[model samples]
Target: MIKTNRIRMKAKPAGNLSRDDFSVEAITIPAPASGEVLIAARYFSLDPYLTGFMRGWQGPDPRWAEGIVVGRFVAQVIESQDQRFAPGDWVQGEGGWQDTEVISADKLQKLEPIPGVPFSVYLSVLGSSGLTAWAGVNGVLKVEAGDTFTVSSAAGMVGGIAGQIAKKIGARVVGIAGGAEKCAHVVNTLGFDACVDHHSQDLQGDLATAAGAPITAHYENVGAKTLDPVLANIADRGRIALCGLIAHYQDMNPIALKEFRRLLISGVTLRGFRLPDFAADFEQASAELKAMVISGDITLQETLSHGLESAAGAFLNMLEGKGTGKHLLVLEEK
Candidate 1:
């Protein structure tokens, strides 16, 4: 028998989740039965959306139970009773906040090798965040060649990919991140045409300069404060693909958006969606993204922390915009 480590919610969080909101718990790993596999979690992903779950936010699912800590992760099959997979195969699944778990083989996605791309891409660029970005830019917004696009939380997993994918389609992409360093990385490292720091003293002015014309499309990941600025700069008849709202994740305090009605008056279209709601298109997006990554057209940056013990700290840091790219916690050896 094997022992596993998992992080469970200490209690339902009030506002701005802290380390006290979670605790590490130990559990026994059961052997795999027929059609089941025992997975050793390799990389556990920490996303800001988890904080909302900890706070009893129902998300898109009004029927979902409150305070449930649900998440996605990369794991390796340590033991399997299924014919499709064998021990030592790398897979991705909803591992929650754990180091190891036993789930049905059907629950996992088997990762195939792409010549140049690392396996981590399954947890990042070709994974949920990347797929979400692809769906938003290509499927929803449908950015066209020569269009101007703006993305909030530009240095984040989804935002960064959306920026790159927009640029790939020949659109001029601009990003808005929290700090100067992340702002620089988005433009210089991520190949965004321009980047704006939301923390800048003159954010509206900086955003106006980076926007480079009326914004044809805005990939909205940060809500409220950022959304208002984005609305002010959007072109008439512009489009918006609303993804996660991390800025308001901590504080659900009602933000009176003075520009809330701009969507109607400006003839802008704002589409809000959760990624899983469009999971049917994931396979198509995955294939396209894997090709782009293998060709070195896009880069995946991950800040990996050691052990399940670090999940809380890593998650909080992500909320504070301290970590760039995907924030991950390495659980154990694959």
Candidate 2:
């Protein structure tokens, strides 16, 4: 028998989530059954979507309710009953908040070593975050060379990757971030043409100044306040890949777009996308992203918190925009 520590939702949040809403508890697991594997989780992915799950939002998977919070993780197979995996295989799966898990082998993807990239990349750039950005930039938006592309929350995991990918496609990339530090990183480190600090006194004017040309494509990560300025600057027939609405996640309310009419008059196309929509193409996208990382075509930043006990705090920190890059909960060393 093995004792595993896991974090579970003690109560649903009334408004902003606090660490008090979660509880870390230990549970015992017997040996795995046939075709099942016992995994020791090394890293847990902390994302904005999990915040919605805590607030009674029915996510894509209904299992993400008030019991054990659901999310992606990277783990090592310590014991296995299936031939596809062995005692020491690193894998990625839906292991949720547990430090140890007993799951069927079919649900896990065996992770191979990528030359020069860290194993944790599987939870970030090579995981769902990367796929979400790829689908939005390459699939939904279909950005082309010479296009002026803009991304909100450009310092975040999904938006950061989308902005870099757009730059690689020869588009003039403009980024919208919260503060001066984040904006500097987006412009200097991510190689965007310009970055607008949304917190600036004149948000609309700054966005317009940075984007001299009308934006041909907009990747929307933050809704509510952030959406209005981007909508005002979009070119006629421009496209938008609506990936996430982090702004409205805390308060369960519809984002009232001040410029909704502009979308119609400008003939702008707005399409909402989820990562699971491109499940069939994940393998191909992962390979391409791996190559991009190895060749320095892309870069990844992470804010890592240690142990299952710290998961709740890390999650809340991400929600409050307190971290750079991907927010992760590291359970153990690989």
Candidate 3:
């Protein structure tokens, strides 16, 4: 028998989420049954999409309703009833906000040890975020050398990876982020050719100046505010990989895109993508991302919160753009 502490959705948020919407509780978990594994979460991932779940968005499965806060976690197997996994193996899966979870073996992915890279990266760069970046830049956009690539929220986990991958492909990458510090980090640390602060007085002009050329490809993260500017500046026949719209996540009446007609007039291609859509390619992409990180071809940044107790607050902070890089809840040190 194992008692695990976890955060549950106590009430649905009317709009912007607050810590009051969540409640922490301890539950006694049963041992894993046949073909099952009991996992102890070591790290919890806080992402903007979880906010939609809190607002009563039904996930892929109808059973993933309110009261259960959905999230990705890096966990260790404490017990296994399946032959495929043994106790003490590290894995990654949708283990929700719980400290311990008993799930089917097929639902969890066994993680391989990577020298020098922290296990937390499995939840960020080498995990869903990295795969999303790769699919959007390499798969959807098909970015090539000499292309002008633009990414919104470029200092964030997915956007950061997208911009870096574009740079590696020899594209002239420009990042758009909030505030001067984040913009600086996007360029200096993430190695983007230029970063424009979206909060600037002349956002459209700034982005235009920084890009210096009509964007050949755009990787969108923060939509609404950032989308129109990029659309306005995109070259004819440009491609856009629409990944996220963090800017409108909290708003009840989200702003409509002003330059949507640009897509039709310029013959641009805009496609929306989710990570689960490219499940088959995850293993190959993860291997490539791991090699890139090891060889310093890519850099990852993270903002960590300690303990499960801090999960709700960390999530709220991430939505508010109060943290930099990938926001993670560290249950224990690696």
Candidate 4:
């Protein structure tokens, strides 16, 4: 057995998370057992869904509080009992927030990476975040030419990609984002037709004017904060991919949107989705997003937090929607 140690963070969020809430400890990392691989984690994907588990939204879940928090990770295989994954292979999957993880073969997917693409992108654009955007834009909403596609949280990982995908497919894309800078990034960087700051006093008026025509499609991420204005301008029979309700999730609050009635009044179709719902489309979405990213059709945005210990703060920032793009932890470099 090749011996090694791992730094793992055990989180117990009493209220909102804090650095103190995360207690880092060092433990022995076991060598891979049969059909398992020992991995050295290089990057961690700090996403909002984790907050639910930490807060015990569903019930008492020890995975988040009493034990090492679980999340998607990119890692290098250091030892492998599985013939499919040899030493030095890079993989992505459900590895907890630790410096090294001993994951079963089934929990890991070998990455077929494009030349020059950073391994970190596998956790961001070319991974599940990109897939979520693809499913929301291409699968649920089916955005197409001449459509006014509006997406909330437009400067975010999924929302940015959704808008870019819509724009690429000839849709007039508009974004609803939190602040002025985020709104500008949604417009200038992601190439959306227009972007409205949700914090604005006249969000409804501004969004309607920016959209010009009735919104043919909406890819929602933020919940109540941006939903009402977007709903007010949605076209009759338009579609909505109810993606992440980050506002609700981060705050642990129930959704009560003013324009929810528009869903009924305008006869709009709203479909809430999880990745498992479109599992069959994962391969296609991953391929298309990778191609677009390589060809410069799709842009990648991310905030890198250095070190495994930084995971808690990064998770908090991501949940609070403080930064644009994917919030990631740099385990290898830090």
Candidate 5:
């Protein structure tokens, strides 16, 4: 019997999520059963969407109960009862906050590390974040040259990459983030043409000024809290790629789109999507991102928190908008 640590999400978050919402516990883990793989976690990603589960937001079937924390991770196969996965192979999968997980082979995706590219990219840029951004910008929005593309949460993993992809498309890209620092990163690091500080006293006016032109394609990550202003500035016949609604993750009140009329009058196309919605295209999309990353056409940014337990604090920092780029927990060094 092997004892390992895992964060147990025992309580439905009442208001804002806190450390009390999760309890770290050690429990015995069984060896890989038939068609299963024993994986030693290397990296755990902290994403905003995971909060919805704790707030009783159901996703797919086989729902993530309040009793266990479900998360995405990069890990190495410690043992395998399946022929496809061999010991020492790296993979990414959906699992919990535990250092090791006994996962079925089908749920995991094999990751092939590119020369000169860090493995962390597999978890961040090439994982869910990259996939989400790709699904929106490439698949849904179909961002193209001459388009004025704007993205909310522009400093986040998905947002940052989305803006960069738009830049690659030769589009005029503007971003929306909380503070001045993040806005700077959106423009300077992420290569966005302009970035709006949503925390400003006049967000609508400021964003309008920065955009310089009506937004033609928008990648939305922050839901209604930031949608209204973006809506006010959208071009007629524009398109919106809707992904995360971080602001509403903890609240259950019916979402009221104050700019619903703008969407209607402008003949805007708004599509809400999750990563799982584009499962069939994951391989080709990820390959495209990987090639871009290797050729320096795109850059990946990430922040690492040492140790598995650091996930809680890292998650807190992410939710409070303290960290730039992707927030990841380092479980194993080398």
Candidate 6:
């Protein structure tokens, strides 16, 4: 018998998620019943969406139940009673914040290894974040050559890929990140044409200068101050893909778009997306992103923490703009 450590959601968080919100406990691993497989977690994806879950998600019924754990991890199968997967196979799915879990073999999406590609890519570039970026650029923005494109959360997982894809399409790429260092990373490492530092004093002027002419496609990842400046620099008939809004996470107060008059006059198009709605095309998106990554056309970076105990701290760091890049947690050795 083996013991497994799991991070369970113990309480509904207040405004910001604290370490107390999660409770780590050890449990005995039961035998894999028929059609089940036991897995050891490899890399867990720590995303901003987890904040909503920790705060007690409000659905149509507004049910706030707190029994199950929160998080999504990529685990490798270790023990199995199902024929579908043998030991040492990696998978991408909801494994929660646990060192090991027993999941139905049929429920897991077996991942194929990419030659010379880092396994961590399964959690960033080739994972949900990367797919979201692809969808926002190709599907929502409909970005074309010669278009001026800009994205917020520029150094983040999705934002970096989104900006690069736009650049690959022959569009001018401008990014907006938190500080000067992140801005430099977004521009120099991620290959964006220009990156605006939102924390700088002359954010509006800097963004305008980065835009050069006018932005034709905008990939919005952060709201509040970032949105206002991007909206102000949009060209006529610009398209906006409304992705995650990280700025208003602490206050939940919706930022009033005072520049709606510009949106109207400029004929800008805005579309909100959640990504899972278009799950059918995820495979295609993954293939395309993998190609770019393999060719060294795009780069990825992450702030990885070891173990589930630091998950809360990582989340807080991300919200506070302290994280350098995509933040993830390494649960245990596979």
lDDT of each: 0.83, 0.88, 0.87, 0.83, 0.86, 0.82
lDDT of 5: 0.86
- Cα TM-score per model: 0.92, 0.95, 0.93, 0.92, 0.92, 0.94
Candidate 4 vs candidate 5: which has greater lDDT?
A: 5
Best by lDDT: 2
For 1-334, candidate 1 gives per-residue lDDT tens digits of 7787777776666666788877888877678889999888888778777676667745443322533355787788888899999988989888557777888999898988777666777888987889899999988899999889999999999999999999999999999998889988998889999998887777777888987698899999988778888888889999999997787767768867868889888999999988887789988998889888977678888888888778788888888888789888887574
lDDT of 3 by residue, 83-193 (tens): 989999999888668878899999998988888888999988887888999999988899999999999988899999999988999999999998889988998899999
Tens digit per residue, CA lDDT, model 6, 1-334: 6788877667666557777777787878787899999988888888887666667654222222543455567889899899888998888777557788887888788888888876778888888888999999998998999999999998888898899899998999999988888988898888899998888887778988988988899999988578778788889998999998887776777678757687898998999998987798888998899999899887878888888778777777777777656788887684
Which parts of model 5 have CA positions greater than 4 angstroms off? 57-63
Off by over 4 Å in 2: 57-66
lDDT of the structure predicted as candidate 3: 0.87
Tens digits of per-residue lDDT, candidate 4, 170-209, equal: 9999998888899888888888999998889999999899
Poorest 10 consecutive residues by lDDT, candidate 4: 57-66
Report the poorest 10 consecutive residues by lDDT, candidate 1. 59-68
* Candidate 5: clashing pairs of residues: none
lDDT of 5 at 60: 40
Off by over 4 Å in 4: 1-12, 57-62
**Positional deviation of residue 129's Cα in model 4 after best superposition, in angstroms:** 1.1
Q: Each candidate: how many clashes?
A: 0, 0, 0, 0, 0, 0
Better of 1 and 3 by lDDT: 3
